[model samples]
Target chain A: QQPVQSPQAVILREGEDAVINCSSSKALYSVHWYRQKHGEAPVFLMILLKGGEQKGHDKISASFNEKKQQSSLYLTASQLSYSGTYFCGTEESTSYGKLTFGQGTILTVHP
Target chain B: DAGITQSPRHKVTETGTPVTLRCHQTENHRYMYWYRQDPGHGLRLIHYSYGVKDTDKGEVSDGYSVSRSKTEDFLLTLESATSSQTSVYFCAISDSEGLYSNQPQHFGDGTRLSIL
Candidate 1:
């Protein structure tokens, strides 16, 4: 099943903070965050494995809550470069590589 | 980048015609996936393969088929194209069963296919 993402879209100013959440109906083994610019392939951001691990890249970080079957992507001190659509993909308990992606969250950061 | 390439970056074909999009990777990764992106759907998985000749359907598998005959190539075919299938298709690969299950998938530039 495709995960559910909160705040379909958000607008922020530089140096602001924003959070995007993804939840799944089934147990998840891992959660991945990616950013896609207009008309481009999604770029990897970070991956949070099961067992409550937290992962981050640059100013972007994510946490996975096995109990809730959810994950959240945190953008700290957001920059204009962070403007893009963010998607979260999840791996179900039984599948290894198969991923179901959320509808996506559009984050717009302005000056 | 993972050295992934998708053929015919842009294509426009009539309805009811058979169209095949090719995804080639030099990384020899064991996992390959095909996904379609639409306005509100984000990216929906059409199919994926764990190994050569081992493929499986995904949530949006209807009207779409996939093949992985070799380690370097995966193909997604539309038996009969339709206007509903017009969207951007992406091919991705991962080296470690995808970042511990939800591993980061390295995506190709994507194929823009339009059914008229």
Candidate 2:
């Protein structure tokens, strides 16, 4: 099943911070995050395996909580270039290669 | 940039017509995927292939079909185009074991389809 993302939309200042959360009902093998600017394909950010691992890229970080069947993405010291739609893709136990993505969180970073 | 190219970046077709979108990868990855994006809904997998001639349906597989006769090409066909099918389509590729790891997927720019 597809995961659900909270705060469908968020606005942040250039130096502000925000968090986007994703939750799934089924057991997951991994959680992958991607960001998409307008009129472009989703760009991969990071992936969290089922073991509750934390991965970071620059000012972005994410944590996967297997027990809660959820993952959260953290964006700190936001920049204008960070504005875009973020999506979380979940890998189910039964479908190893198949990924189900959440609706998405639109983050708009302002100056 | 990932050696993935989707042909006919923009397409416009009449409803009920047959439309085929092609995805080509130069990396020779064993796994290829087709996905569609719509407002209020994230990228939904249409279908994917593990290897040549091997394929499986995804969550929203209706009204769509795929073929992978070779290693570098994966084709998605809209049996009959509909207004609801108007959306951007993405093609992704990954290595055989990358599917089980944190390996990121490489995506093509995308194909914008409009059904009139």
Candidate 3:
């Protein structure tokens, strides 16, 4: 099943922070995050496995809670380049590599 | 970006016609997937291939078929294109060695298809 993302859209000023959450009804083995700019391919951000580990790169970070089937993406001190549609993909334990992505959260960072 | 290429980046076809989108990857990944992106519905999996000649259906596979004759090429076909099938198609690849492996999927630029 597809995951659910909160705050369908968010607008933030440069240097502001925002959080995007993804939750699934079924158990998840891993959560994957991607950012897509207009007319561009989705770019991989990070992936959190079932061990409750938090991973980050630069000012972007993500956390996965297998027990709650929830994952959150954090953007700190947002930049203009961070304006894009954020998507979270979830993989179930039984699924090999099939990922069901959420509806997406549009993040707009203004100057 | 991954070494994935999708041919005919943009296409327009009439209803009932057959359409095929090609996905070629140089990464030699073990798994490949086809997905369609529509407004309000992020991305839905259409089909996936685990290896050459090994493929399976996904969440939305009713009017689609896939083939993986070689490790580097995966093809997605719309048996009979319809207006509802008009959307952006993306081909993703993953290097997961096994079913339980945790690996990130890299996506292609995507093919924009319009059916009238």
Candidate 4:
């Protein structure tokens, strides 16, 4: 099943903070995040593993709650460069490398 | 940035014609995936290959078939194109697995296919 992302879209000013949430129906082994610009492929942001491990971009941080089967991406001191569509992909315990991505959250940071 | 390249960056074909999209990667990642991006639907996985000749279907595998004859190349074929299949297709590769599940995926530039 695909994960659900809240706040379909958000607008923020430079230096502001925003949080995007993602939830899944099934138990997740890990949650992956990616950012996609208007005309480019989705770029890797971070990956939150079930057992409390994180990897990827330094500017953004995320958390995965294994108990709730949910994850959240936190953007602190947001910059104009953060403007893009953020996606959260969930991996179930049974689905090895496969991921089911959320609908996506559009974050637009203004100058 | 993973040395991944998707061929025919843009394509426009009519219905009923067979179309094939190719993804070539130089990273030698064990896992390769094919996803379709549509407005409001985000990216839906169609198929993924764990290794050469090791392929599996994803949630939205209908109307799509895939083949991985070698390590570097994965092919997605639309036996008979349909209007609904027209969307931006992305190819992603990841080295994540049992011991390295934290590895993030890297994507190709993507192919914008338009089936008219």
State the C-alpha lDDT per candidate.
0.90, 0.90, 0.91, 0.93
lDDT of 4: 0.93
Kept native contacts, fraction for each prediction: 0.81, 0.83, 0.79, 0.77
* Model 2 residue pairs with clashes: none
In the range B36-64, model 4's lDDT, one tens digit per residue, is 99999999999999889999999889999
* Ranking, TM-score, top scorer first: 4, 3, 1, 2
Candidate 1 CAPRI category: medium
Worst 10-residue lDDT window, candidate 4 chain A: A50-59
Model 1, A44-101: lDDT tens per residue?
9998887766555766777788999988898999999999999999989886678888
Residue B7 lDDT, candidate 4, scale 0-100: 94
For model 3, residues A1-111, the per-residue Cα lDDT tens digits are: 889999999999999999999999998888999999999889888888887654436567887877889988989999999999999999898887889899999999999
- Residue A24, candidate 2: Cα error in Å is 0.6
Q: Weakest 10 consecutive residues, lDDT, candidate 3 chain B?
A: B96-105
Across the candidates, what are chain A's individual TM-scores? 0.95, 0.94, 0.95, 0.97
Q: What TM-score does prediction 1 earn?
A: 0.95
lDDT of 3: 0.91
User: Cα miss at B42, model 4 (Å)?
Assistant: 0.2
TM-score of 2: 0.95
